[model samples]
Target: MSARNAMAAMLDELMGPKRNVELGKDTKVTFDDPDICKYYIVGFCPHDMFVNTKADLGACPRVHDDNLRLEYPKSDKFEKLGFEREFLKFLSRLDEDNQRRIRKNLEKLKANEENGQKKEDLRKLRDEQEIARIDGEIKLCMAEAEKAGEEGLVTKCQELVDKIEQLEKQKTAVEERLNNTATIPPPIDESAIKVMEVCEVCGSMLIKNDAQCRVEEHLSGKMHMGFSKIKVTIEELRFDNGSRGHLLMLLDISVNVKDGDHVNETDHVIEIGEGGLDRVHEIAIVAEVVRATDIVGMIVIGVTGTETIATDDIVAK
Candidate 1:
């Protein structure tokens, strides 16, 4: 049921014919006697007698004064009506005071918020001003140096220029460090050169390639030579008879020897061997390529302007 209906039913039940105590004349009652007057006032029984004794019904007694009896003839029958009127009057007094305090507190809170925003704006403006001041100071320093015609002034400008260059280099280095990481290739097994015994009489080192010095029991008998290997991705492989097949093959690749034993290549392709049994052809396989980005390290070749081969026919030459 709704609260209004529930309350009305409860009031009807209390003031119903059962406990028949009606006020026909102005009655004298005390807040202390809650047991007799409890149901008439609050529509409930006092659960705890101790709490009932401590509780005070702080209603204005002026409304219940006997001298005011001639005003309302029905007031004598409803003493609760007078108590409620006096309670509303008490609340009105507090409501006025609360309104003034609420306005003052709200204003103070708004002022503090605006002040904080102002401080933040001022801080941002100061930062801008500081940057402009530094620029201005640099220009003024340069102008003064030019006017004075002193050699030390030019040196001071050079120092500042060097510092700026260092800062620029540091920025570029940091950017690159963030962008890339070094990847070392896993090591492969290889034989090392044997070490020769010293000539006993002269304490001279012997050549490792000599027959007598090429012993496994020597201190450095195994020599490892690290060479770059290339894997060829071939689209069509043809033999002397014109038989064609697709192949993927890896060969030990090297640069073509030049004047000072330096390897040189303008493109990725490499012709590995001459017309002999031990000869082999090695080709560099490009992994990927982009039109705009600069290639770094060994260029990654991809299937650009090139055909891809089938996988099954690769042979070790």
Candidate 2:
């Protein structure tokens, strides 16, 4: 329809087969077509440019750098001009009806050029029609192949069916798992395990077993709510008989109050380190302590941040 398009159509009619043959490397030419030259010749694929310094054309280039010029076979003394021959062969075999139609349109286009209509528009229409014909032929070929149950065609269909069945099975399994998990209530009180740490020094109510954290402060920096710890310290305090009560009590840290409770600032219960010298640091705890006589808690404190740190026995101070 458009002038440029019409011109391309005319060019294709005259040159399409020649071009295809040239691309097939049947016919030899001193110079490559400008468009093909731009891609295959001037533009160098980065990968090839990097490794192969040779001028030989490989399958493709490795790199995609913009600066590289394309390398093409352009020599005055060339051997195989098969490209041009092959192109001419294809062009000669072009559909006779299409060719006649093209010639008629071309004549009409020439007449119209004199009659005030642009020649370029006619050329574009002819090219578009030719392309459409080719496209239709290709579509027919594909449909025939599909109908005949070609190997790849059947394989592709089977693959798609298998994929769909797999997806359906996965969906069913996931749904079943969700239903089963739903039937069993998620642990209401189990999630606090990571946030739970018992003080080895104070000998908290936690059942002590591993001697790795004995007679030392539980180096758990801070436990989340509902996690408990026992803090213990011996201070030489002058009591009524010249002896202090030696306040050694296990502090149970928990979310003891709900959000609306009076002491609820984020609802965390305040037990130890709230008032008096029973403050957090002064306890002089054998950090990370357990009831074992041999092990200490400070050992855990030494390697706290590691995920799978092995515990060692605490050396009594």
Give each prediction's root-mean-square deviation over alpha carbons. Answer: 44.9, 41.4
lDDT scores in order = 0.33, 0.33
- At residue 172, give the lDDT of candidate 2: 54
- Model 1, 140: alpha-carbon shift in Å? 3.0
* Candidate 1 per-residue C-alpha lDDT over 277-309 given as tens digits, one digit per residue, 9 for 90 to 100: 221121222111112113232222122123322
**Candidate 2: misplaced stretches above 4 Å?**
1-160, 175-196, 200-240, 243-317
Model 2: residue 280 alpha-carbon error in angstroms: 30
Question: Candidate 2's residue-wise lDDT over 1-317, tens digit each?
Answer: 46776565456434541455634566433234433322222222222321232222233312122222322234432213233233222223322323454465556544644653344356445545655554555555455556546656776655555554554565455445444534434457653222222332221323235345632333342221102211101111111111011111222111133453233344322222332333233233322232212222223212222322222333233
> What is the TM-score of candidate 2?
0.15
- Candidate topping lDDT: 2
